[model samples]
Target: MAGRIPHPTLKGPSVVKEIVIGMALGLVAGGFWKMYNWNEQRNVRAFYDMLEKGETSVFAEEKDRGPD
Candidate 1:
């Protein structure tokens, strides 16, 4: 009896293409995450700076002032 043909391979350029696509997708996701969290990061940094500068009453004053 005749032997059956082998399955198609998926190495070389095909693998490289998949890797590139995956990396591009990862970069896009990371960019979106950074963009979404930009404001939160900025606020955290601002709070840290205020604490460093000894502005301990800023949050209390804001609470007393209520909503803008």
Candidate 2:
């Protein structure tokens, strides 16, 4: 099987396309990471606020259950 396999030549336009695609992917990933970090920070802040307010059980359910 010594047949010459034809491969598409990677040239200037293809290189530019690759760069643009890579940048787009990076931006999307960065946005997701930012959102995750923001959510984590928000949860931490809420926990601290609960502690500041003297919550005995930080993870306890609210005692306002209406019925069993």
Candidate 3:
């Protein structure tokens, strides 16, 4: 347990490269995730309208089909 220890671990730009790559991927994924949520929010009003219009197609699929 003895070596040149001044932030010594792969003593190169390895850590910086890793951090940059990780940040880039994380940013891309985060942006896409935000876009998806924004889209969902944008379409929420239409979904609610469907619900308000007595539309059961979406949520009533697994419900008990009652007597004729």
Candidate 4:
């Protein structure tokens, strides 16, 4: 065993690659989250507009009621 030389591990490049991949994934996830929130806000604003125009209701009518 003493005659065999130890092999060096390539850790630096592997760690850098991992960090880059993590940042890319984080950015993609953050973008999706922002898009989701924006869509929700837009929908809420549309609903409020409809309500102000008397085109929608906050409570269901008796004829539109479902099973209890």
Q: In candidate 3, what are the lDDT values of residues 7-50, reduced to their tens digit?
A: 74565668888999999999999999999999999799778888
Per-candidate Cα lDDT values, in order, are 0.85, 0.88, 0.84, 0.93
Write model 4 residue lDDT over 1-68, tens digit each, in one string.
46978899865658878999999999999999999999999999999999999999999777956778
For model 2, which pairs clash? none
Model 4 segments beyond 4 Å from truth?
Answer: 1-8, 11-13, 64-68
TM-score for each candidate, following the candidate numbering: 0.44, 0.64, 0.52, 0.74
Superposition error at 43 for model 2 (Å): 0.2
- The per-residue C-alpha lDDT of model 1 at residue 19 equals 94
TM-score attained by model 1:
0.44
Model 1 segments more than 4 A misplaced: 1-13, 43-68
The better candidate by TM-score, 1 or 4, is 4
Clashing pairs in 3: none
Model 2 TM-score relative to the real fold: 0.64
Query: Candidate 4 deviates by what RMSD?
Result: 4.7
